[model samples]
Each structure stands twice: as C-alpha cells, then as structure tokens.
Target: MPTLKELAKRPERLTPGHRLCAGCGAPIAVRLILAAADKPVVAANATGCLEVSTTIFPYTAWNIPWIHSAFENAAATIAGVESMYRAKRRRGEIDEEIYFVAFGGDGGTYDIGLQALSGALERGHRFLYVCYNNEAYMNTGIQRSSATPLGAWTTTSPVGRVLPGKTQWRKNLTEIVAAHGIPYVAQSVASNWRDLVNKAEKAFHTDGPSFINVLASCNRGWRHEPSETLKVMQLAVECCIWPLYEVENGVYRLTYKPKEKKPVEEWLRVQGRFRHLLAPENRHLVEAFQRYVDEEWEKLLKRCGEA
Candidate 1:
C-alpha cells in the first residue's frame, strides 16, 4: 500500500478542469480509489452530480476508460464489463491486468441500485463498488435518500412545524454491504485520503466482491463553507458520527479511532442542515441525536471487539 506522500506523486486518474463544484468531495473520492490501483483501471460512474459535472457532453475529466451508467446500475454495468474481460482473457483475446471500480451516489447505491449491487456481489463479481455518499439526492434538488442522516433538512424531508427533519437515522450502508458477506467492505471519507486509498487497495485485491462507503460531502447541499469541507469531515470522524472501519471476510476492524472523541454537537454545529436542531424548541432532537450516535458508536466498537 502506498502512503499519502507516495500516492500524492502518482498520476491522478481523475484530472482537474471539470465542472464539479468547488470543494465537492466526490471527485476527490473518485481520484483516491482510481489512484489506489496497482494496474490500469476501468471505471463506471452512475448518473449523478459526479458524472454530469465531470462529463459535460463536449468535455471530460476522466483520463482513463470510463463509462457513464444509469442512476441504478453502475454495479451491474461494471459486473458485465468484468465478466466480459474474463471471457476475453479465457479466449486469449486480451491479456492485460485491469482493475474494475463503480462509482455511485447515495441515492443510487443505498436505494435504487442496491438490488443490482447485491446481485453482483452474490454472483461473486471481482469489482469494487464505491458509493460516494453525499447523504442525499444532491444532484436532484437535494431530495432525501435512505442514507441521509436524521434531523438533517432536505427538500423531501424539510424541517417544518410538524416535523424535525429526516424522521429516521442514516442507513448503515457499510454494515448493509457487509451483510452480503463479500471479501471486503469498508466505511471511509475523502478527507482521509490515506485511509480511503488503503481500503480501495484491499477492495481491488479481493478476489470476490468489495464495497466502500465514502463520505463525499456537498457544500451546497449541506450548507457549509467551501473551505470548511475537509474540516467538517474530520469533525465527523472525531465526533464518532462517522467512524473509520473495515470488515474483511466477516472480521470487523476499526481503521481510525480518535484519541479523544469529541461531542457530536461539534459536528452538527458546522452544518446548516442541522441548524434547526440547535434551537431551544428542538433541544431534544440534539439530545436524541447524541444518544443515537453514542449508541451506534458503542455498537461499532463492539463489532470491532474494542468494547
């Protein structure tokens, strides 16, 4: 595995001069995984902000072979490509090593494409599915998705007089993927490029299937300053709102744990999505949110055998 310093010198598979918004974490997440490969990589991206922004009809940001799959089938498309590559290899039509990676947003991965993803994983496809989770249908008017955190305002789950925000917690996509019993599954964030690349390498090396859930925040959707994007992600990890962990072959291990866990309020305070929760009237929402985070953190620690 390459360290951050080493990876920094590698040629970026995803280049700049694209339309992705400033401080968007999706492109960074894509670059990290693409750089993690030891061989050539064939990439597929689901229809979302990443694809639309990077591949605006007349131009492209991807320097490698890339496919723009539909909103719900990035996994299936990559699996088909991998299957054909294997067929060609068997027939001696081609004899070059290439890694496969599929990129999807939370809307595509957590909700729409989950069945396809599950099928591909169950069939033992040798590919890595990377969901750059922005926590909502960000490209589509900031609608809520299954992966949206509780008490976060979205177009679909607006905080009103009757409702606080999303009525439920964010879907545990990593644990859900781990349930597929694939060879590798991990939860990561783009802010931590080293950890993200390390997991990407493990996924690419696995013979069967692998999945990584990356926190790719949206400055516009989350209502945070563009410059504060990385800080917000770092706070998420330090606050235990998002723990860094990996599950390989059914064994859970935490990749990054804070020496001193900060309060979840530190995370919530930075995002406008949770601004309403800070009000005195919605005080219990904050309390409930903290309780939920604590419980989930403890559960993850137990899963990793740290408790």
Candidate 2:
C-alpha cells in the first residue's frame, strides 16, 4: 500500500466539481480505488447517484475512459469492453495494459444488477466490480434495497403503525460473490482509507474477476449531518456491522477487526434510518439487531479461521 504522501502524488482519476451530495462517500471510495491502480483504467458506471451526479449532459468528472451504462448492466458492459480489449491486444492493435472497473449502487448491485453481475463473475471477466452500498436506492429515492439492514427506515420500508423499518436483514452480497469462486472479493468501508486502498490494490492486481462491496454513507438518505458521514461509517465498522475483510481464492481473511467490538446501538443511534430502534418500547429491536450482527461477525471470523 502506498503511503499518504505517495497516494497524494498520484493524479486524480475522479476529479472534483461534480454535484455529489455533501460528504457523500461514493466519490471518496472511487478516488481511493482508482488511485491504487498502477496502470491505465477504463470504468463503466451503472445508472445511479455516481453516474448522474458526475456526468450531467455537457460535463463529466472522470479523467479516464468512462462509460455510462444502464442500471443493471454495468458488469456486463465492462465485461464486453474487457473482452474487446483482450481481442485488440491479441491482434497487436493495443500494447498497453489497462484495468477495467464497474461502479454501481446497492440498488443496481444487490437487486437490479445481480443477474448481470453474477453472469460476469461466472464467465471469469478480468475486471473489478465495485458496489458503493448506501443501503438504499438513494439516487431515485430513499427506497429500501436488498442491501438495506433490518429496522432501517426507508420510503419503501417505513416505520409506522403497521410495523417497524425493513423487516429483513441485508443480503450478504460479499459472501455471495465470493461463493462464485472468484479470485478476489472484499467488504470495505470508505472511512478506513488505508484498508480500503489495500483491498482495492489487491482487487486490481488479481488476474480474474474481483468484487469489492464498500459501505458508502448517504448523508441525505441517512438523515445525518454531512460532516458525520465518516463518523457514522467508522462506528459501523467498530460495532462489527461492516467488517473490513477480503476473500482471496476461496480463503477468507479479516483485514481490520475491532479489538473490542462495540454494541450496534453506537452505530445506529446517529442515523435517522435506525432511530426508531432506540425508542424505549423498541429496545428489543436493538437487541435483535445486535444478535444479528454478532452472529454474522462470528460466521465471518470462523470463515477467516480467527474463531
């Protein structure tokens, strides 16, 4: 991994002056991932916050070759592009080695684009697929997605007289992708720059398919102050809600583990989405949330052989 000074010296791939929300983690994650690339890169972005915000009709924030694809075809689009690159290289038409990356939100990744993503991975495309998971469809509206955690409020999963927030736990997309026997798969967060960059470096270096699911905080949808974005994400990691880890060649490894895992409430209390769980009458819901986190963390530890 490059030192902070070394990383700062790399030319910016995702330039500023776009309209991404204040304190949005997506751009930060994108910049970090791109900075770790040692070669030229071509990126495909699914129709989501990153795509719409960064490229408004006449303007674009990307410094490298970029393609704007449909919400569910980022992986497929990048795969096709990569295939073309391979063919061109074989014909001696292209001499430079280039990396391919696809970016999508949770809505495009966990729900709409799952099929395309799955197929791309199964076909062994030499590319990196990054899912900037904000837990909901923030681009369209704050609608719940398969990546949304239980007891989190969203437009589709409202907390009212009928029931609480989202009733089901989030889909473990990282593990699902890893199950495809891909060369590399990881779960990272935007707040931890070093760990995220290290994982991005590995993902880019892998010879086969790689996927990194990064937790990107949505200040608008999450109903938190813009400045609290990193704080919220860091708490999520410390509480074991979003463990930083990677799976390489079917072997799981924990990259950053909290010395003492904090309670889930510490992570939930700051976000309005999970505010209801802190109510006196809803104390049990918090307990349920903790139990789920604990179980999932244990499962991950066991897989990494740390349990």
Candidate 3:
C-alpha cells in the first residue's frame, strides 16, 4: 500500500480541463479512486456527469485508459473488459498488473443500471463498481431517482400542494450491493478523501467484485453554492444521513463513529432541496426524515456490532 504522501504525489489520472460543474463531486471521487489504485487502471464510466463532462468530442480529460459505457450497462461493460483481461492473462498476451473500475451516478446505479450491477456482482468479476450518488438524475435534469432522499424537492417530485418533495425514501444501494455477498462493500462520502481513498484501495486489491456508494453532492441538484460541496458532504456524515462504513466478506464494520450525532436538520439546512421542510407545515416532514435517519443509523450500528 502506498502512503498518503506517496499517493498525493502520484500523477493525476483525471486532468483538470474537463467542464464539470464547479462543485460537482463526481470528478473528486474519480480522482481519489484513481489515485488510490497502486496499479494502472482501466476505467468504464456510465453516460452521466463524469463522461459527458470529461469527454467532449475529440478532447478528453482522462489520462488513463477509459471507456464511456451506456447509461445502464457500465457494470456489464466493465465485466466484459475484465473478462478479456483474464483470458489474455491466461494466454500470456498481457503481462501487466492492471486494475478495473466502473463509475455510475445514483440515477444509473439505483434504478436503470441496477440489474447490470447486480449481475456483475453476482458473477464475481474482479472489478470495482463505484456509484457517485448525487441523489437524482442530475445530469439530465434535477429529476427524481431512487437514491433521492425523502421529502427532497426534485423536478419530478416537486413540492406541490398535492404532496411533499418525494414521498419515497432513498434507496439503500450499499446494503443492496452487500446482499450480493461480494468481497468488499463500502459507503463513502466525497468530503472524506482519506476514508474514500482507503476504500478504493481495498476495492482495487480485493480478489473479487467490490462496490462503493459515495454521497456525491451536486451543486445544481442540491441547490448549494459551489464552495459548499465538501461542507455538504460533511454535514451528511455528521447527521448520520450517510454513514461511513464497510462490509468485508459479509462482516459489517463502521469506519467512522461520530462522537455526537448531529440532527439531520443540520444537513438539510444547507441545501435548498430541503428548504420546504423548514416551513411550519412541513416540520413534521423534517421530523420524519430525522426518524428515518435515526432508524437507519441504528440498524447500521447493530450490523457493525456497536448496538
């Protein structure tokens, strides 16, 4: 394993010329994951913020070998790439140690690409699938996705007189991926670079398939200032809305245990998506969101044997 200092000095895999939104978190996730891998990496990215932004016509920001997969088949596409690598290694066609990584947004991972991701995990491909979850279809528009939080306003699930932001709760993608019983599974946040890099390293070194779901804050979708991306992600951890944890070979472990669990409101306060919850009439909705976070955190604690 390379020391953090060594990793810090590694050449940038994703260059800086891309046109991603000023505060988009997906690029940060990509850079950290690429930096963590000790071996050269071949990446497959779903058609989302990362792909469209990084690859504009003939120009590309990626310095590594990268594939732009369809919105719903990044996992399957990367699986095939890994399969070819294995076959070539057996035939002595390629002798280098290379790593495989796949990136997808919450919209692609939580809904459209779920089946492909599941198949790849169940088949035990030697690759890492990372979901930079911004909680909605941020690339196309601020539309609702399964990963969108409850009571959060989106274009599809607006705060109309008919109902609150979104009636359904956010999908549990990390747990769902863990259910495949793969070698590694993790829930990371973009702000926690060290934690995220460590998980990416483990994912890279794991013998079998691995999955990581990162809470990628979207400046446009979440309606926050560009500079607030890291702060937004930190609040998510502080409030226990997005816990830092991992499951290795079916055993759950909590990587970060907050000394004081701040209320979820702290997280909601920054983003305009949850602004409606600040109203007196919608106070119950915030309470409901808080209850959901508390319950989920308690469940995670139990799984990690901290209950």
Model 3 C-alpha lDDT per residue in residues 36-69, reported as the tens digit of each score = 9888999999989889999998999999999985
lDDT of 1 by residue, 1-307 (tens): 8987888888888998988899999988998888899889999989999999988878889899999859999999999999999999999999999899999999989999999999999999899999999999999889999999989999999999999999998878888889989999999999998899999999999998999999989999999999999999889999999899999999999999999999888899999999999999988888898999999999999999999
Question: Which one is best on lDDT?
Answer: 2
Ranking by TM-score: 2, 3, 1
Every model's TM-score: 0.98, 0.99, 0.98
CA shift of 164, model 1, Å: 1.5
Candidate 2 error regions (>4 Å): none
Q: What's the lDDT for all of these models? A: 0.92, 0.94, 0.93
- Sorted by lDDT, highest first, which candidate order results? 2, 3, 1
Per-residue lDDT of candidate 2, residues 106-168 (tens digit): 999999999999999999999999999999999988999999998999999999987899999
* Predicted structure 3: lDDT: 0.93
Cα RMSD (Å) per model? 0.9, 0.7, 0.9
